[model samples]
Target chain A: EDQVTQSPEALRLQEGESSSLNCSYTVSGLRGLFWYRQDPGKGPEFLFTLYSAGEEKEKERLKATLTKKESFLHITAPKPEDSATYLCAVQVGGGKLIFGQGTELSVKP
Target chain B: DTAVSQTPKYLVTQMGNDKSIKCEQNLGHDTMYWYKQDSKKFLKIMFSYNNKELIINETVPNRFSPKSPDKAHLNLHINSLELGDSAVYFCASSQQRQKGEKLFFGSGTQLSVL
Candidate 1:
């Protein structure tokens, strides 16, 4: 079974704190890895898309990197508005997306 | 302008009631999808339709049915709603299956079953 697991289910970080969230996956065939930020009561907002191993993408204070079996979402000097659940998902065959449980991040000022 | 949108931002109903949540995309995309996020915040794809063709159905219960009237519209109808069905439902769309474009998601609809 293709599985995606996100570690540190929840984290509390002070403003300006930098940390990384881990997502490990095992799939039959990996096509793409995606990162999304979701606020309370809202759907996920697309962040970055990594296609192959050693691929990396960045947006503001967020950077996403993918490896052969894992992906990392690195947050740098996160602001309070950046407090949201970060979701990691992968695409297998036929565009089927398998998502991880998500890492809830809280940034306090 | 919203690229993707879902109707009824919040729904509260009793068990056994049937309800329909509608979704529409204005991105000129050819594929639409429905995803369910449970209380634990696990997002899972329930159905995917491409140009009105059923492409992916993830072993969801028969009570959960997705209908795509066209390339831009996809509706999910749940029969005999149960408490466990209460969750945040999201509607998303992409450019195409072969391209595997990134999805544009709606704000979401919260369903509460009593």
Candidate 2:
């Protein structure tokens, strides 16, 4: 069965703290991996898309790196406003995205 | 202007009642989708339409139906709503049905079944 799992279900960090969220997957015919940021009571916002191993993308304080079996979303000196649930999804055949349970991060100022 | 939008930000109802959630996207995208987020905040895809044609339909209940009246509009209707149906339903769109395309989502509709 194809599956995606994210580690650290919940995280509390002080402002300027750094951390990394993990998303491990086991699936067949992997097409892409995606990252999204979702706030409370709102829909998810697009962040980045990784197509293959060793691919990396960065925006602001967030950087996403992908490997053969897992992906990491590294937060460098996060701020309060940067606190949100980060979601990871893997695209398989037919463009279907299998999502993992998101990691909720709370950054206190 | 909002790129993608859904109606009824919140819907509270009793079990067995039927309701509909409407969605529209102005991004000129060729594809639209419906995703459900449960209490654990795990998102799962329900249905997807490309240019008003159903392309992907997951193993969802038959009581749930998705209608795409046009290329830009997709609506979800639930019949005989159950208590387990309470969740946030999100409407999303993308440029195409090809791989590696990022989706643009709307402010989800929170559904509560009492």
Candidate 3:
């Protein structure tokens, strides 16, 4: 069975703090790995998609890096507005995406 | 414009009542999906439709049916809603079956069954 596990279920950070959220998965075959940001009462917003190991993508203060067995989302100098639940999902050999429970991030100003 | 949208942001109904949540995507994508997020924050895929064809159906009960009238619209209909059915449902869309394209999601619909 395909499974995704995210570390540090929740994190509280001071404004301007940099942190990293971990997402490790075991899939039959990884087509792609995805990262999304979801706020309370809202749907997840697409962030990045990494296809191969050693690939990295960045947007604003967020960076996603992928490896053979896991992926990491790094937030640099995050602001209060960046506080939200960060979700990591992986597309198995099939076209369906299996998601992690997510890491709740709170940025205190 | 909203890339993906689900109608009735909140739905509250009694058990045994039937209800429907509608979803549409204006992104011109051919693939659409429905996901359920439990109160504990576990998100799971319930169904997916690609170009109006049923693609992935995850062990969802037959009482819960998904209707895709067109490629742009995929609506979920629940018959005899139960307390266990209460959860936030999200609608998402992606382009072709190709890899590397991210899925765009709607605002979501929160369902409460009492």
Candidate 4:
């Protein structure tokens, strides 16, 4: 069975603090790993996609790195605006995405 | 312009009533999907349509039906709504049903059943 698990269900970080969220996945064949940020009362926004192990992508203060069995979303000196629920999803050979339970990040100013 | 759009951003109704949520994507994608996010924030896929054809249908109940009149539009109609059916429904589209295609999602519709 394909499954995605995100750890640190909730995290509270002071402004300018750096932390990392983890996503561990088990799939039949790894096709893609996606990261999304969802705000309250809004839909999810795409953040990054990593296709292979050792791949990494970055945007501003956010960086995502992938491994064979897991992915990490690293927030560098995050601001209050960076607070949101970060979701991790993995796509297998069938093109369907299996999503994790998301990590709620609260960056206090 | 919105890449993907869903109508009735919020819906409130009583149990056993019927309702529909419409979704349209203007990105010219050939594949569209419906996902439900429960109160626990667990997002799950309900259905997927590729070029107006059903490609993937999860174990969702039969009361929920998805219609894709065209490649750019996918609508969801739920019959006999129940309190347990209340959740946020999101519409998304992808260029194709490929292994790594990025999906564009619309603002979700929050459905509340009394």
In lDDT terms, which candidate is top?
2
User: Clashes in model 2: which pairs?
Assistant: none
Clash list (residue pairs), candidate 3: none
The local lDDT score (0 to 100) that residue A96 gets in candidate 1 is 77
lDDT of 4 by residue, A18-103 (tens): 99999999998888999999999888899999999999999999999999999999999999999999999998654688899999
TM-score of 2: 0.99
Indicate which candidate wins on DockQ: 2
lDDT of 3 by residue, A3-50 (tens): 999988999999999999999999988999999999998899989999
Candidate 1 C-alpha lDDT tens digits along A1-109: 9999998899999999999999999998787888888999888998888888998888899989989999999999999999999999988887878999999999999
The interface RMSD values of the models, given in order, are: 1.3, 0.8, 1.2, 1.1
Give lDDT: candidate 4, residue B70.
Answer: 98
Q: Label model 1 with its docking quality class.
A: medium
On TM-score, the stronger of 1 and 2 is 2
Question: Per-residue lDDT tens digits of candidate 2, residues A5-51?
Answer: 99899999999999999999999988899999999999999999999
Please list the C-alpha lDDT of all candidates, in the order they appear.
0.92, 0.96, 0.93, 0.94
Provide the fnat value for model 2, as a fraction from 0 to 1. 0.89
The number of clashing residue pairs in model 4 is 0
TM-score of each: 0.97, 0.99, 0.97, 0.98
For candidate 2, write residues B1-63 as lDDT tens digits: 999999999999999999999999999999999999999999999999998999999999999
Question: Which ranges in model 3 have alpha carbons more than 4 Å from their true place?
Answer: none
From the highest lDDT down, the ranking of the candidates is: 2, 4, 3, 1
Model 3 lDDT tens row, B44-68: 9999899999989999999999999
Query: Could you tell me how far off, in angstroms, the CA of residue A27 lies in candidate 1 after the best superposition?
Result: 0.6
Count backbone clashes in candidate 2: 0
